[model samples]
Target chain A: MLPELLQGVDTGGLLVIQDSASYSGRHLLQSFINAALNREEAVHVLGFEVSEEELKDGLRGSPVQRLHFHNAYTDPLGWTDHPAFTVHQFCLGELTRLVKQTSHSKPATLVIDSLSWILRHVSTPDVCRTLQQLRKGGAVRSIIGLLHADMHQRGTVGSVCHSATSVITVEPAMRGDEAVAKITKRSKSGKVIQDEEIFRIKDDLTVVVQSKSSKGAKKADSEEQETDPTANLTFNLRLSDTEREAKQKLALPFVFSKEKKTALLHSGPGSGRIHYEPDANDDYDQEDPDDDLDV
Target chain B: MYTELNSILNTTPDSFTQGEFVLLSDRQSDASFLIHHFLSLYLRARCKVCFVGLVQSFNHYSAISQRLGVSLTQAKEKGQLVFLEGQKESLSVLIPQENDTGSQAMDFLRDPSVGLKNLYEFVRSAVSSNGEEGGDGSEEWGPPVLLVDDLSVLLSLGVSAGAVLDFSHYCRAIVCSQLQGNVVMLVRCDGEGEEDEGDDEGSERLMKGLTHQCSLTLHVQGLPTGYCRDIHGQVEVCWRRRQGDGQYTQKKLFQYKVHDKGASFFAPGTSSAVL
Candidate 1:
């Protein structure tokens, strides 16, 4: 899906980017970052799963001035005296305080680099409570959290998904070497739109979404390339319209038709008889001739 | 030779991309041969290798690698290979010795909260690069390749399936994402869904979860007509190379016969009927 279908710049809600071990949602999250930056919404990243250097390296050529990255990766649990935000401080108040102190009244985007890490340490109800509070009332425009589906219990992942306004699941596309974002967007009127689109993160960090129909057309094009025997031949194997009509009209040597059958049954001159003239050299040998030779 | 498999997989040493995740699994027959094949492949590619051998000892792998014409000892001496014997480490972790503070490989045994963090960290630190850009250390090496013999042993050790999956996730972040290396995990799954074994649920969940995430999956299973003198089993290779113009998965099945030195792959029924 493109920007509008992705709920890029809409009213405040929780957008959960759920991923698995196979297809990563990092690039899609980057696309979301671009969307927020396009609107000039202040960006705050809570990166617990990755280092700041890696995050900076990912957005190398992009303008990162408005981007405020919180370093929870260096020491999420306070292993050393590193001056950074710990995973324990991943609460609604802390996030709101960070967003309010950094930007003006314009709603800012809050990204929890991943929700799986918090779900592991924090209780399911607690995380869901924070998600609800952040979405219902705050300066938060859209809260995006990356949740790894395989790392949590089914019931746990389900409960977290229940608290989300949009759940974009990253999965490998069925056709090609591309990844699909299965987005389940719940709009303000409580309408849910489920769509699967093949997406690529451009070098400039823009999401190039390939719709389902175009992907199917591309597949059909490839199959058309392989299966058509008439394609790229030395001789003209196809027939013209008139030639095909003439071929359809031409009858073979078999003289069996309804008129012929009726004429033979009724219009014969007399009784049908077989007349044979046997020559002197033409000797008709019966079964007895072969029987004598066998004995 | 791996020419047949290489052609089937469409992978060569030069084209083997960094940051790829490979999964090897078997339902009926053994798939350890594939792991051995990858070990030989990585060693020949001149990449720094870390092998977390949980199913067998180091000597067993050393012997297998020798048959494949690659010496693990020489690679180890050159600091190009790191081998962690899970059997030995599990033993050491199970039965503590007096003042044996050296081996922290199985520290997850005592600390379930950290899960396989210590083991994952060991893999991350052990295969530290030599002269190249260091990820977690500053030694000397080329691209890092982490190969786990199998992950089911961790499940059998009472570690939760989620924990085992988290271990792989962390490994992917460090080995594949940060370091731009490759991670290969082998898991054993018996049956799925309706025919699910009551106790093998963890391994099954782990395998199913992994299959969804793997860039390439080789599912090895025994022959349907039972064991034959000529054929051992079949391997179904599913290649999901996710970012090229040719993005679809190519799945093909081939039968294999395991000899002492190496194995041979052929189309189904051809190997037994012809050979």
Candidate 2:
């Protein structure tokens, strides 16, 4: 999924990787490196968050001969050496110079391993300015900046996003070990397009784009179905009193006649039936007002 | 004619009253939605807005406003909106030492007090200019609203806590007291990438000071449930308002689903939504 997406990234455009705490962006970076190598393009890595050894090991098996590294990480001894270039951690000038010199000759893909380090030393605007300069300078054909989205303020992230032509956000999925990579922002030929896709990493380090028709998709579909006007329709049977009586009569002949006579007698007070019974409860009700006056 | 957020504000008797300072705090994930939600409401109400953008570029804000169905271009043309670029100014401070354009960059970089003063002056000028030229004559023009996007960025740029606090006080004084306008400021609460211990302390102090001064504080936080179904994240808003009698009223937690367009408050079991 990422390789295909990387293929879509136009030359001389800026791509931002919004890395989360899960390190899901590492895979995307690897995929980008692989894609660039496959295209026979030179890959220049500006390592700040990771060590040079780690970068070499990560891309060891890849068939890329023109791999260059500019190490910016300082060790505990406060001494570092790289074949390409080494500078103090917070010196933006040296870093900018290195980036410019590397992409000066040919169209190379410049990858900054992480931007959080730079952000720590300089403001987001400075970082954005540097990136804008790089793009405007036309030195690097493609600039990929990796940023840990969880670590920075929203404004910082927004500034970085504002500076980028494309933004890919990688987040962890709710379900087991899978991560979701989304093309949250993509600018193609001066037009911005937004797309989100769920993906999972495999054992072979290849990204498998999960279909949207997964469990969550089905749940959303069901929700849509629920909102349909016809979904709430329910069928119920109704019976009137006469119909119920008729049904009862059909079920039992003698029992129905007795019930019918009782129903007719109780239907009205003037049903032409004579009654001479004494009112037993009425006599008690009349005496209760005086009998209970002891209170 | 107001948006859903205005309607929500209408629920409270004194919510969103004139001359009030509103502070919105959220994590990095849900900040944009909250900011956009309120900004859209203000814009739709046809209020004059001076947006000091420190976190996002003007283009980014414009794109977001367009996506959310707010006419940013029209607002700007009518002098109903003005965007003051804080990101560029804040970043110019960090330009390499040798290449520094001495006078201008040095003005902002020499001291945090100067940056805050510059910001105050910029906002005052923007609001006054927009108020004078408010083009629509159908309705009476009220005081122009002032919005500061993300105060934490200033602190991250080595601004002192005292300077940030002073800046907030000045903004509130200008918008709430002097101009009788509304001031909405955004501050990020979570300290994610702040490596320095002193920086964290400064940010906390700034937040506390702002909270003490602001009339209303909306705290937006992402739920731990992660993403479920169509819900990218769950946000719980705790709105705290300061009353006239020097007491604070705590509102119920408003739960919402953070979606692509914006955040929509959840009904008990139904999904009536908002952007």
| Cα lDDT computed for each candidate against the true fold | 0.76, 0.64
lDDT of 2: 0.64
**Model 1 over residues B96-190: C-alpha lDDT tens digits?**
87877656878777666567767866886775544544354545656889999899888877788777876786676667776788888998876
TM-score for the first chain of model 2? 0.67
lDDT winner among the candidates?
A: 1
Each predicted complex: what DockQ? 0.17, 0.01
Q: Name the candidate that leads on DockQ.
A: 1
Q: Write the per-residue lDDT of candidate 2 for residues A1-295, one digit (tens) a residue.
A: 3555677466657888886533337656766876677677777887755455545655656765767777553221122123234323334465456656654365778888777656744677777877777766655677887887755567989888887888888776665445666775555556666666777655334567776525558778889877757544585367789988898667465465766888866777655756787775555556466764577
Error of 2 at A82 (Å): 59
lDDT of 2 by residue, B1-275 (tens): 12444555662223357766788877545556667776776777666788878788888888888888887778877677877666665566566466655224224455665546666667767766644554556344456688888888787777776666656755665566656778888888666543444436666556655654555667666555554554444443333332333222334355566556665665323444333
- What is the fraction of true interface contacts found in candidate 1? 0.24
lDDT of 1: 0.76
How does residue A93 of candidate 2 score in lDDT? Answer: 61
Candidate 1's error at A77, in angstroms? 6.0
